[model samples]
Target: MAKIKDHPLRYDLVNELHARPFPALTVPCHAVYVAIKEAEHAVNRDRAADRAHLLALLDRNGSPHPQPDATHFSGAMGRHHLKWESHTEFVTYSAFGSGVSSRAFDPMEADVFPQDWLAGAPGTRLTSVLIRVEELPQDEAEMLAKLDDWFVPESLAMARVVDGAAVIAGDFRIDPAGHMRFAVFVKKGTGERRVGRIVQRLCEVETYRAMSMLGLMRARGLSGKLNTLDPQLSQLISGMNSPDHSPEEVLQTLLKISAELESLAVQFSFRFGATEAYEAIVTQRVSVMREVRVEGRQTFGEFMMRRYDPAMRTVKSVDARLRGMAERATRAAELLRTRVDVERSAQNQKLLESMDARADLQLRLQTTVEGLSVVAISYYAANLLAYIAYPVTEGLGLSKGMSMAIMVPVVILGVWAMVRRIRHKFH
Candidate 1:
């Protein structure tokens, strides 16, 4: 066992590599040491012959020899103590029971390939490599040159060493006991930008995928309602669902469908709201009209009492004037009939009185004429008698004149009495 010193720069040297896990070649240090020891032993046994043969093979093949395929490498290392595995075509070489390994040399395809000869041994400590590099002599220039080539500085800021038979990134070195080890260091900022680019690409792809899904879902919903559509509208909707359409185009069609739906919703809402408002107004107006009708009836009754009654009095006055004119016309007609009747009655009474007066005057005139006629007849008869007497009396003695006087009075009396008797008979 080697006594190891604590190295402060060891943490910085391996920080980057330890930050992330990487697929690389790994081999146990014990297995690598054993393989080197076996090669040295083989060289000592037939040094002259083996050296000549190695030189000839190198001359013939070239500087770096090509590794065999995976199957060939696996078969060759199957009997070794170390077990080798490939990750993403990179080989991981380690001892079967060792907790340590060394990664060196990339394969042709950039894979990590494990050496077949190193197997079945324990791993060396990371401190062993630094101790071995410190033990190398710096006496001769050629020896110093060899050491310089075998061990490399870890980085600009860290002091570290790399020493092994295969100096992957440093100078070769050996300890007092002839054991070997290799450096394990990390590189910072390696492949970080590449990873970031890959992550961004993934995000963009996922976003577009989500948008496409949403458009398809909306298109499906629209298609379900197509049957109730108008003929002209259905034709337009059918065109949007065509098999050749892209998701973006389908989304545009869905936007147009939403526009039409919004317009219909607005129109229906306006009509319903307006109709409700109108009905309410009409109901209010009817109530107002009913109130007005009641008021009008009451007002008309009051008008009949205040204004119409006075107007009716004026009408009665005009009626009285008309009645007076009708009565005057009736009275005039009656007066004319009465005047005609009175004139006729008076004329009839006058005619009857004149006839009576004329008859009475005729009767009085007839009586006077009869009295004169009797006086004349009696006077003649008396004269004749007197003449006879005178003749005889002259012989005896009487006068004819005195006898005429006496007969006149008696004749008047007899005419008057005869006239009175005739008048009585007529009565």
Candidate 2:
């Protein structure tokens, strides 16, 4: 039997599931994460430049380069482990070091990413996060006390995740170091892989949340534009009901409104869509933790609902309003077109009526001219006949006056008969 052939993408497809594996993390470790995205037109940016930038960082560490077309990479950079992943519109870098700094949440923890190398990045930083993982204390009370010292009591959201194998706490606030902070406490005997997964989830929640808010910022900028357009559109739509404006004029205004709205929609379409996707991912990453309340503390899901959900809602509301305005403009344009067509038909009808009246007047004038021609011809024929009958009257001993009288009626009858015959032949 011939061997079955494999599909061309079979290997790639299967390997994708295992790609970007969770980092195997031990206790007393720290991680710093950064995401970078282009300031403008990020989705269509030169991706090769991003890859080159990644290569530059790897070269600085004397590390092996990732494959030419690779989207993710993992390597050792001195005392830290570097992991990089490229996304549709951005890129992320994370570095894990084996031990925490002497000062908790120290500003220097971010030094895993060299300052000079970061300055050379092709894009701006979207967000940066610092995460710390430590072994649980012998007593649970000590861990709770540490959480209080590290995070704000009012804003802290601590939970027992991974079936209580670990506890996670974060205030979701930026520290003086300009980075969000997260802390993980692992239960004794908990595997390193599980702890790593929890830390990764924390990084993702922060990263995706920041990314999602970009959409909100874009929406807020567009909101001012929408405010200007809304009143203009409403004014134009109201003009449609006015009898003073011509259909053509109203149509012109409607078309202009439609065009401007469409242009705005095109500009912000991708940002809004990307925001929605990132929001869902943020929510998913938070929910996947299966977080349960730890000592009745707030959870990540609740914090997002309170702080993040409102921003997402604003973007959605603005997006919907834009669509509604476009639809209204379209409907108004159609109505104006119909009105213009009806007015044109009425004008054509008036023109046709005037033409009919002109034709009737022309027919009457022609009949009067024909009657005059008949009278003039008979008079000339009578003279000619009277002259010819003169010689005959003398031979018959008749007077010229008598002869003329007799010829007058005979000539008139002859001319009238001749005119009738000619008119009948032509008809």
- TM-score: which candidate is best? 2
- Give one digit per residue, the lDDT tens place, for model 2 in 127-196: 8899888887878899889889988898998888878888899998888778988999888888888878
Per-model TM-score on C-alpha atoms: 0.21, 0.85
List candidate 2 stretches off by more than 4 Å: 363-427
The alpha-carbon lDDT assigned to residue 409 of candidate 2 equals 80
**Best model number under lDDT:** 2
RMSD of candidates 1 onward, in order: 59.2, 4.3
- Per-residue C-alpha lDDT of model 1 across residues 337-362, encoded as one tens digit per residue: 45446757888889889988987898
Off by over 4 Å in 1: 1-293, 297-327, 342-364, 376-408, 424-427
lDDT of each: 0.34, 0.87
